[model samples]
Target: MTIASCGSVSATTLGLPNSTAIPAEKARLPKGLFVAKIPVSAKTKQRLANDIESITMLSLLQARNTKLAAGTRVPEILVIGLRLHEPNAAVPTDIVELIAMQRKSGMLFVCVRDADFEGTTRQECAFAVRRALPARAGHTTTSKVFASDWQPAGEATLNATDPAVDSMDALWESLCSQVILDDPSPIDVNTRLARRMQIAQLTAQVDKLTRDHQRAKNPEQRNEIYAKLHKMKRQLEELQGQ
Candidate 1:
């Protein structure tokens, strides 16, 4: 029954407290559960099985048990650790999404892999934070996963220095910023994530338009594609500026 101090989960162990390791099997979902609940393709299921070595519940963060205040949006946070089978590969997002969708609390995944560096073995870890948006009028709730770049397990640390972390939700936002890197302007995590998604979509659209412009045989078709591409690029620039 040890409580972690504010921002106590270091990058090496990924929120895992020394005294509170849950049974490894408890972290694993039952077979067929993903297939039954989530629309998982056979390929994704196999990929998750092949990439993940083990899953375990490392720690649970709550206001009652920890120093962080209770949040209206997020009452608790679950710290789940995933060990990868392959040192270079990551597990599919399908499994992470499925788990996040089922849980009420915020989900944070810490994935680790062991790789050889200059004839010496070293461990690397990556962090993923889940943001769950409540269901709107006539729409179902959805969750988005934001992941971080892999870091050497021995050195990286979570950034919890923001003074705004007065509640669990704010703390979650701070962690999300660590993984995704917040925008330059002052905006909440949800708004920043939405803008990011929009940027990705616009970038993909511009790429497709560029390819179409290259393939167009008629001058008129090329001109049309150029205009669309220009507009998309402008939109992208605007979003990025914000």
Candidate 2:
């Protein structure tokens, strides 16, 4: 197993010589960090969501120094789970756009195979990474892509029914030791905090709208509440998408 040195810490010292180990305290992904799921199909989406949930649950259960959750806010990492039927499957433009947005926010992007599907080729994986994470003109040399074919340990494989959970655990190990690119310029701390505040405010508004819609007794009043609720929901989605 190859281990990359991150900052002043060696991967071996971080307990990541192989992808099966829990990351050291300093090497763990941020607590309460959001991991966005991007899967093209409904089936794949559900699987990916389950995978993320399971990964978080296992990490917490084992007392790992990481706390992750699926969120709509600007994510720290974007997992693109695709099931390719043909060797030449085209990646959708909207997906590319979403990736671009995440990249601009200095988030890491990873492409994985969907549950119960054949894995994508290294070439395909590399292509997705490159497209999603284009290097700046003078910083081309800094752009590096890491690829690994990971298999879960026998215990994890036997205990977990969903393959995605194991895949996520392996991915977490990769992330801990810089197998994936670390954000060079993380989103400003103040900006992120402020955005969270805004989201909270919007969410409260949504809750109020829901209550109003539920209490309306007349059809005309219900129609008015419904329109307002729809607008608020759309705005919330747009903010979360960002």
**Considering every candidate listed, which one attains the maximal TM-score?**
1
Ten consecutive residues with minimal summed lDDT in candidate 2? 54-63
CA RMSD (A), model 1: 5.0
- Error (Å) of candidate 1 at residue 33 is 10
Candidate 2 per-residue lDDT, tens place, 35-77, comes to 3444355544443344222111111111122232332332333
Tell me the tens digit of each residue's lDDT in model 1 across 118-223.
8897777778876665344698877677778777776546644467777777776777777776322213766666777789899999999999999999999999
- Highest lDDT model number: 1
What lDDT does each candidate get? Answer: 0.67, 0.37
Question: Which clashing pairs does model 2 show?
Answer: none
Error of 2 at 138 (Å): 38
